[model samples]
Structures are given as C-alpha cells and as structure tokens.
Target: MSSPATTPTAARTPRKAALASWIGSALEYYDFAVYGTAAALVLNHLFFPTETSPGAAILFAMGTVGVAYVVRPLGALVMGPLADRFGRKFVLMLTLFMIGGATFAVGCLPTYDQVGMLAPALLVLCRVVQGLSAAGEQASAISMSLEHADEDRRAYTTSWTLQGTQFGTLLATAVFIPFTLLPEEALFSWGWRVPFWLSAVVVVVAYLIRRHLEEPPAFQEARHEVPAGQPVSPLSVLLRHHRAAVARIAAAAMINTVNVVFTVWSLSFATSVVGLDRATMLWVSVLANAVALFVIPAVALLADRVGRKPVFLAGVLGPAVMMYPYLAAVHAGNWPLIFLFGAIMSGCLYSMANSIWPSFYAEMLPLPVRVTGLALGTQIGFAVSGGFAPVLASAVAGPAGDNWLGVAVFVTIACLISGGAALTATETAQKSLDEIDALHSSRTEAAELQALGTGQEPAAGRGAEEPAASGAGR
Candidate 1:
C-alpha cells in the first residue's frame, strides 16, 4: 500500500506543469480551431459542394465541425480511464501525437472535385481521430496543473490551460486571415491548406515541452495506494460515487456553446450570408481571442479571490444577454457594433467562465477519478452543446439563414442551463485538493448513510463544517 519511490510529498512543480499544459493545450486547440475555421470558411466549397444549393453545402461543412465532438465522449471513455490508471504525462503525450498527426493529414486530403464522395468521408474520419485525441487533452492537462499547484493558487495556475486555448484560437484565425484575402483561384486551390499544414510546427514544439514533464505527485501517490495487480476502475468509481458531480459539470460546461457560436457560426453568417468581407470577419475572432489572452488570466485571479461561481456565473449570464445584440450587430452589417459586442461578449465575458471551469470542475472529485470524471462529463456536454452549436445555429436560422434572433435565442437557452447548473455547485476557490476530496468524501458518506437508514456521522466531516473560502457562495 506504500511505496518509497512514489511518495505523495514529492516536489511539486507548478510552474513547469502549467507551462507544459499551456503549450500542449495550445497545440491541441490550434488544430481544433483550424478545423472549425476551415469548416466555416473554406470546406463548404471544397469538400461539400451542393452546386444547386449553397445551404446544403454550409450544413454539411458545419456538420463536419460537429463530427469531432460526437466522438469525444467515446474517446473520453477510453482515454480518461487510461490517464487515471497509467499517468497524466503518458496520456498527454499520446494525445498530442494523435491530434498532431490527424491535423496535418487534413491539409493533405483530396477535395470533393478530386475524390467525389470519398473527400468528405476521409475528412470525417480524420475529424473523428482529432476528437478522440482531444477527449482527454483538457482533462489530463487540468489534472496535471491542479496536482502541481500550490494550495492557494490552483485557479490561477489552471487558468493557463484555457489561456493557451485562447492563444490557439487567435493563432488559428490570424493564420487563416491572409488565406481569406488570397485571389479566389489561389485561395480555393491551396491557400487554406497552409494553416492545417502549419499544425506540424506546433506539434513538435508542444511534444518537446510535454515529453520531459513528470507525472503529478498526487497521481503518482494514488498509483501506489492500490495493492499491486488490483487495478483501479475509474469509470466504476465515477459512475457509482460521483454521478451528481458529473451531471452538474456537464450542465455547466454547456457554456462553451457561446464559443462555438461566436467563433464558427458567426464567422460563416457574417461572410457567407451577410456579405461581409471574409478577412474583416476573421479579424473579429483574431482580435477577440487576442484580448482573451489577457482577460482569461485576469479573471482567473479574480476567481481565486472572489470564488469561482460568482465570476463564472457572471460570464454565463453576460454572454446570454449579449448574444442577441452581438448577432444583431452582425446581421445589420454594422462594423463598429459588431467588433464592440464581439469583444465584450466573447473576449471579456466568456473568458471568465472559460478561465475558471478547469479549476472548479477538477476540485469536485477525488484524485482517483479526477481525470476520468472531468473528461467524460465535459466531453459529453461539449458534444451536445459545442460540437453541435454551429450546425444547430445554422439550422435554426430559418430558410434564409439570417434568422439571427433564433440563433441568439438558442445560445441564451444554453447559457441558462449552464448558469442553473453552476448555481448548484459548491464554491471551491482556494481549497486544497485534500480539503476538496474530504468534502466530496463527506458528502458521499452522508449519502450512503442516508440510503442505508443509518443516520451516522461522516468520517470526513471536517471539510463539510468549514466554509469554502472567505465570502465564497453556495
């Protein structure tokens, strides 16, 4: 039950872990964001050509964007358990290779004109591989960051995971901008593939950073806790002991729909439907995410002080209210309002939630199931809300594809679900992992006692008696 080699008190490397997570996450999301941008701007024509009706082409292209999400939950079921059982660093390295390889392959695929139905089929297969790799990326990264962090600064440290994502989105959009401005013949011929091909560079950089990283001390210690040859089943533990935690996390993560709608749907709506300049519309994303690079860390620091729920719920509701006007500005072809609302809604407001969820959700579970629970729950939610958001928004926008009100309403409803779910969560800012684990254990014991009609005290009731953080909300 105890091993000298895998001590729980091993040196913590918060800064190193955070840096590794940031680079790996940036590379993973860069690949993902590249596909989303291509789906919106370029793939509709090259891979999904409905010569008689552009709407069919748009739907097909956006549907491919959702394809990865569809498989992410399935991937999570496999990768999550592997990370929890093997180690965070191992899973992270494996996922990095899978995502990088699949993304680079996207650049080399044949277009619809060259390969007929085979083009779209191959594209979907590559997207499925990407989704599988991404399934465990964020969860494993969050676990690594949280385990390595100082007790007082988990939120700030974990925020780097999402900050990297913002940077990835910015880089992806910025790279795609010149492609949009290319001469139509050249643009369609080869310009768009350049961004996907560039994924190779980031893969090498991220792998170099992640490979040298050590497994978190917490994970290593947990590995030794079990008797040798009696492997831990993280899925069984997750489903049996943490169903409510998983449900709440899944519901709250629906907030990511704001990002999908903003980054992907809005881009296509502005350029393809509303006749906006493609480069200008792309710049809106590039600028908004550029601002998010600063905004995410700032808001995360605030969450560390004020508690995660308040900052995150503010983000959820702010975007819900702002979605209407943001889409309205786009539909009206008003440049100033578009940029203003876009930056405020996504760059500032959405970053608050994005910045906090990694720390907040990870704190809801114990060490053994942390990665598994986070990956499965968040991936399922993402598949439904984020993966399908662009396709759903496009479908709801009426026959003319300009029903901005319907899209706004859809996003608002997703926010309501997210906010409502977040309201039910315990505020976990500034809590140490041990304390949070104790709290969850206490709750589980209490629930089990109730089910058994025993009415006994929980063994770990100390965590339940203490207030989470000064002024932390329910």
Candidate 2:
C-alpha cells in the first residue's frame, strides 16, 4: 500500500539499515578475518610444537580455521527462524554480541605451551561460537537492508552491507600487518593477541549504531496479514513455495568459494609455498580489500541500471578466467604481478558479485520468508564453499607442492557453477519490495487457475477449484 512517493522515503530505511549493517558486518568480519590471517601465518607455530613436518602443522592450524564454518548451518537454522518470526534487529544484535564476545575470548585463550592440547580444544569451542553468530549476521543484515530498499535502488543500497564486509577484511589485514612484522619472540607470545582483543572496540561501536535501528515496514505488514495463532512459519512457507529460489541461491552462493580461496588459502600459499613474507600477503589483503570498498559500490550502481543478472554474470566469469594468471603470478614470486592479480580478482572482479548479492538474494523471496530463506540457503551453500576452501586449496597444493594450476582449476569450477545458477533466476530489479510478495501470490493464484481451466488439478488440493481460480486471474 506504500505509494511511489512514499516508497522513496521508505527506501531511506535501507540507508539506515545499511549504516547499521555496515558497522556490524565490519566488526564481525574484522574479528573473523584476523583469525584467518593468524591461522595462515602464525597459529601453527604457536599451538603445535616445532617439528620436521611443518606442512602438516600448518594444515592442522587451517583446519581449526575451518571449524567455525562447520557450525554455521546450525546457527542458520536457529537464528534464521528467529529473524523471520521476531525481527531483523533482534537477530542482528544477538549475533554481534556473540561474535564480539567470542572473538575477545579467543584473545585470552592460553597458548599450547601453557595449557597443552587443551588450548587448541578451547580455541575450537570459541570458533564454533563465532561461526554460529556469523551464520545469521549477513543474511539478517541483507534482509533488513533489502526490505527497506526502493525497487530500482535496492541493489545499490544493499551493496553497502557488502561494502562493510570488505572494509572489515581490510581492517583485519591492516591490523595484522604490524603484528606480523613484529620481532618473532614478541609476535609469538603477545602480538597476535592484540588483533583479537581489538574486537572489543569494534563491538562497542557496532552495538551502539545497531541499537537505534527500526524494523523494516514489510515485516510489519506481513505480521498483520497472517492470521492470529495460525502458527506462521517462515521456513515452512519458504520450503513450500520458494524451493526454486532456494536452489538458485545455493548455486549463486558458490561464488563465495572465490572469496574463501583468496582470503584464506592465498595467504598460506603466498607465505608458505611462494616464499613471500607473511607480512607481504597481509599487505596484499589490505590493498585488495581497500579497492573493493569502491569497486563494490560502483558495480552495484551498474547492477541497478543494467539488471542484476548481467552484472552478476560478469563478476562470476571474470574471476574464473583470471584465477590462472593470479595464482601463477604468486607462484613465480612476482610481487607486482601478485598485487595486480589480487586487486583485479578479489577487489574488482569479485566485488561485482559481492556487492549485488544482498539485493539479488533477498529479492528471490517474499517478505514472510525472506530472512529464513536467505540465511538457510546461503549458509548451507557457504558451508561447502567457504568452510572447506582452505582444505581443498591445501589438498591441491599436495605434499612437496605449490601447484598453482590445481588451485586455479578449483577456483574456476566454483565460479562457473555460480554463474550457471544466476542464469536460472527471474529478473526482479524493476519491481517494488512491498509488491514482491503480492506479485508472487498473484502469479501462484493465476497458475492454479489456468491449471484448473485446462482440466488439471490444483497442486495444493484443498480449495474450491472454480471461484478462487477465476478470481485469481482477474
């Protein structure tokens, strides 16, 4: 019922939500990415005793990094329904507190020398907490932003949430550069803890910004439309009506593998195999992320004008093609080439997909199930893509190996799968947010009507076949 004039004003809600989403996502990923940086460069040395087989120790350390992702699906199942039923703001707040608290706890955990094997076990427990919080954070934030966005501008506005994530990555890498550069003795004992402890500052700032946000109006309307005591369940509705959307989202979600490989595995590859200093890889991460801050918003603007699918397709295809050259540069020990590859692949090419996904994924669902569908679908897909990317990348590198071709092949396949998924979705850029659910409802009703008139039974199987069907087409 929001008019075009009022719709513009309502869209301002996304801008507000974007601000909150940006800060919260920035803080959360800062904590998370810092851990990845450490896992790649330092954790094995600190947690595992110096041994002849340093590669195995590094692999074990990276496994710990992947452990958090193992908990993501559970977090999605628990928190997705909560966001759908309660409010986006509530879930956002809960995730921020959990991520921040757990990150801070990681800083305080005793090293292996102090606590023996118990130290790594405790580290994994805290990581699970971080994973659970993260599972719902991006989805909830995107839902909040997308629901508040105006139709034509949705991609641009929601892109800010993604921009925040890149900012977090940049901040995380920037923070770790100095720590990694510290004298080995200092870095081993206390310097690594500084980045984790810094989560306290990010958490405090994000909490204050998010506390003032209001729930999206679409959610408010959905609450009114559903019958009282009818046990409205977003998951149930999503499974029943939005199965195609879920599949599309999962396929599109595979693009995250590009990010995880670059962020986690590249760091390890560059430092361990390519013989680049750990500090150099961290600097590359910082620069790539800084570039992403601008590239993401620019690609998002282009998506709004040209349509989401084309922009998304370009993002997906660009990375697959670029993966070989990028990995090869690192293998050849070309610093300039390494920076160029990172900037283009991670910063510019991948940003095209990263920036637009908040709007693209949210648009695939109706207001009632938007949060649950986005969270569950993306998190489930990300479990395979992001969680195991490091392990896969390591496996490809093999024993006594720095196989850049193998890494490139792995990255290319993931990107192609994501592109194929994007091609299957309906174009939704021109439609209003509030009308999306209604439009979908009308389509469903019309399809049912046409089936009945053609002598086909309705799929739902309970309603009066004639009047309801006739009225639907009208």
C-alpha RMSD for every candidate: 5.9, 5.7
lDDT to native, each model: 0.83, 0.79
- Residues 414-454 of candidate 1 have per-residue lDDT tens digits of 99999999999988886777667666764333333221111
lDDT of model 1 at residue 404?
A: 90
Error of 1 at 287 (Å): 2.1
Candidate 2: tens digits of C-alpha lDDT, residues 135-229: 78988998888877776788988898889887887788778888878998899889999999999999888888888787786565434332322
Q: For model 2, give the 10-residue run with minimal summed lDDT.
A: 465-474
| Residue ranges of candidate 2 with Cα displaced over 4 Å | 1-12, 40-60, 111-118, 181-190, 224-227, 266-278, 390-403, 442-474
Error of 1 at 312 (Å): 0.8
Over 4 Å off, model 1: 3-8, 39-61, 110-120, 179-192, 265-278, 387-409, 442-474
